[model samples]
Target: MDRKQHIAIFTTASLPWMTGTAVNPLFRAAYLAKNGERKITLVIPWLSLKDQKLVYPNNTTFGSPSEQESYIRQWLDQRIAFISGFTIRFYPGKFAVDKRSILPVGDISEIILDEEADIAVLEEPEHLTWFHHGKRWKTKFRLVIGIIHTNYLEYDYPRSIVCNVHGVNTKFLEIGKKRFEQQHGSNQAFTKGDYYIGKMIWSKGYGELLKLLHDHQKELVGLEVDLYGNGEDSDQVKEAASKLKLTVRVHPGRDHADPLFHDYKVFLNPSTTDVVCTTTAEALAMGKIVVCANHPSKRLLQAVPTTGTEKLSSKKFASVSLNLWKTIEDTSAYVHHLALGFEATRRVFGAIPGSLQPDEEQRKELGLTS
Candidate 1:
């Protein structure tokens, strides 16, 4: 019998916080542990209610460590199959309000010593203070791999890999679609308006979107958009939208797999800061036309057939909106083709050794022989 490979994943975020960093790493862990040939240990930060409140003042779903662990287990049980070898370990942590992240306060090397993992995968290692602080002990692990999920260009690791695109949990999305069909009837077609789902902050392109709509009201008179998310600027966005000539409704954030996402004809993501906007990928996977911003960070999205990246100017935004609204194609026809490609990407985590290859420079930096 082949010996099992023990993999340890150190992540900064987890369930009860639905950011892409939290959701994607958890899915990777579940997918890697599904076949029972590997032992998966997911190490997450444990913040007290006070620290969590300081960092995420708007959040209300946080609980004690035990409660949070239970929530994660129940979530995986509902979405994934054969998660028997998966384990969740929590380490003491504190909040860095300026960075908007939690830093592990305890010794992370202790977890490595206890777990005896053959490989250690760091999700967004640049954001993890422990990774930088414990460089002397990194050699304890047989292999260390870093997966960059943000747009911090200066960050470099020996085996660091940056993904321009990420995968979604299509199984959960399919289940949500079936549930929606059962409740609302299969005849429900796509709605005429566009929609956006993500954090409602100004840096997320709310200012640009509102400005474009307000500046070119005559060109986009009939256009309607629904914005779903919550942030410090939620009320401000709502007040601004109310003054626009076009119809714009601001709603609270919903789950990424909300079946209502399938009802929209187009998805709008004007943010240029994201390196690999997971929601935009999810929209394309759902067969919806996406109008995203054209920036070097978002170049990967241009490869998709149903996505258009436009300059962030008011004129360009107005022109793209008018052009895309001219025709709404059948979204259902493209769902299978696009979704299967994303599903295939998720399976790559199961074969990490073969999938991730470091260049010669990176290998030399880590003092590894090819």
Candidate 2:
């Protein structure tokens, strides 16, 4: 019989606070575990001042701080390291260290010492400080994987296992390619895009969008920029719009707000730090043109309106000329332009098996990450 390959998924977060890096690794690990191809263990820490479930796989109560220690203790007691949070099937795996005093390196190293894993993958290698301890873990895991999702990593990472691009936008890829070329020339690199775009955040920067609309309305009269989202940012958005003397409307959120683009000619993405920039995809998904800045995904759309040459460069702003062009120009043709791109990309990556909580669909429909 083939031995169950031991694998450790190291995360730098508590379950509840787990980000995409933390979540995606588990998804990949779960798929491998379900196939009986490997024994997968997820290591997370307790970061909450008050204990809570960091992330109980598949919505099962397994890894919350409240349930974590007891659950892990029980798993160790049973000599079981990995279990399918989706299928609840018992599989052999290990978990011991996390984001506490033990850095990502310490936690991963400790687990290797204890269980002597066969493979190791890290969510954020920036959190790992194991260069000196390389020999200690050299023969422990056959494969050591790392995820790099930011352009900054182009400078920080000595080498990358895989580049998980957040969205499949041509513009995003163009900038990434430029950044990569700047670093190592246009060489073949292992990279994938995570298309989780157009999320309706609670703080939908209506204020910023409103400010744009408000300031430009005189030159671009009666042009409505459809703002889609929910959250604390609602009032600020509305107030910003009010100050700009532009009309503001908030609609109910959707799992895939494709229908929202029907009447809207322009899409506005006013995010300051979210790298994925879902609206850039939503706009492309609907072929509704988007006004995004330095966003890698913006290139996939019809036009970028502006481009940035330097990091955080404000390459272009809403100029009187651009606003006039957008307000009167025919925008009806751009709405479905990005459709073909979205579908092709989805098919290739969707086959990568990953488990979502039983409640995930409902939560998505309800527009709550809770």
Candidate 3:
């Protein structure tokens, strides 16, 4: 029998971080490992928040690195206990406050070599200085795939793939829906209001959202906005929202699969920096109309019928948001289709191609030949 192909995924962060880079790759790893066709090693940078004395936005507290690793292992084992070929490996690293990331230190190339990975997937390769320097890991793996998760422009690698949005785990969405229905009844209705769930940072367009509310106070007289997230700028966001005439409330972040997420009629996101805004996809999958800023990275979202993209300005943002709210129709019918849209876009991860042999065009793309 052919041996299982060993695939090592090097990611910037893991469970305790609660960011897209951490969560997305994790789900991909779990889903890919479920079938047990290949051996998967999810490599994450490790550092204790207590040791670093750093305040993480998600408000999760870990006593030590071992505790964090144990928690993650337990979580994964509980969910994927049947999968024997899966593993999670932690490497020593430090958190970068400015970047809000745990960058892997030491020799990562040697680490990947030690794993004997037939394929190495670098999630957000640009964030890893050691991997994106070119040609270093090129000859080592049968194929090196760089999955760009950010908007960084300078970093590019052989066999690079740009996935505008990653796939959502339909199982979680189904569970949330079922729980909601069980508690509220099948005909339960959503509250009439706007909602936003993501990092509470300023770059998420909190300034734009507040300005839109302030400038259009008269037109949006009865509009209510509920924002849920945790970030270093949480207090600042709350202070800004307090001055607005509209009813805006800031709350701590919740799990992406929380049923509360489905209790809103509209979802608003004005951030353009996200290369793959996972929450936006989740909102749409839950049948909520999403109003976000127009950007090249949001191309996939723009294609969804329930999503609207507008220029990043208070005026246009308010106009599109109110227009979508006013013209809103029943969205329940679009859930399945929207989920399929995201799943189809991210099918590459569902069943990764086994063959490492690249065709002439792919060979050129991988720089295998002149």
Candidate achieving higher TM-score, 2 or 3? 3
Q: List the residue pairs that clash in candidate 3.
A: none
Ranked by lDDT from best down, the candidates are: 1, 3, 2
Q: What lDDT tens digits, residue by residue, belong to model 3 across residues 170-211?
A: 754664465466547766557567988877888778889889
lDDT of 2 by residue, 198-223 (tens): 32343334445555566677887654
Poorly placed runs, candidate 3 (over 4 Å): 49-59, 63-66, 73-85, 113-115, 130-135, 153-161, 172-188, 299-370
Off by over 4 Å in 1: 1-3, 54-63, 81-84, 130-132, 135-137, 153-161, 172-188, 299-370
* Backbone clash count, each prediction separately: 0, 27, 0
**Candidate 2, lDDT over the whole model:** 0.41
* Least well predicted 10-residue stretch by lDDT in candidate 3: 349-358
> What C-alpha lDDT values do all the predictions have?
0.66, 0.41, 0.66
Model 2 C-alpha RMSD to native = 21.3
* TM match of model 1 to true structure: 0.70
Query: Looking at candidate 1, what is the lDDT of residue 163?
Result: 47
Clashes of 1: 0
Candidates 1 and 2, the one with greater lDDT:
1
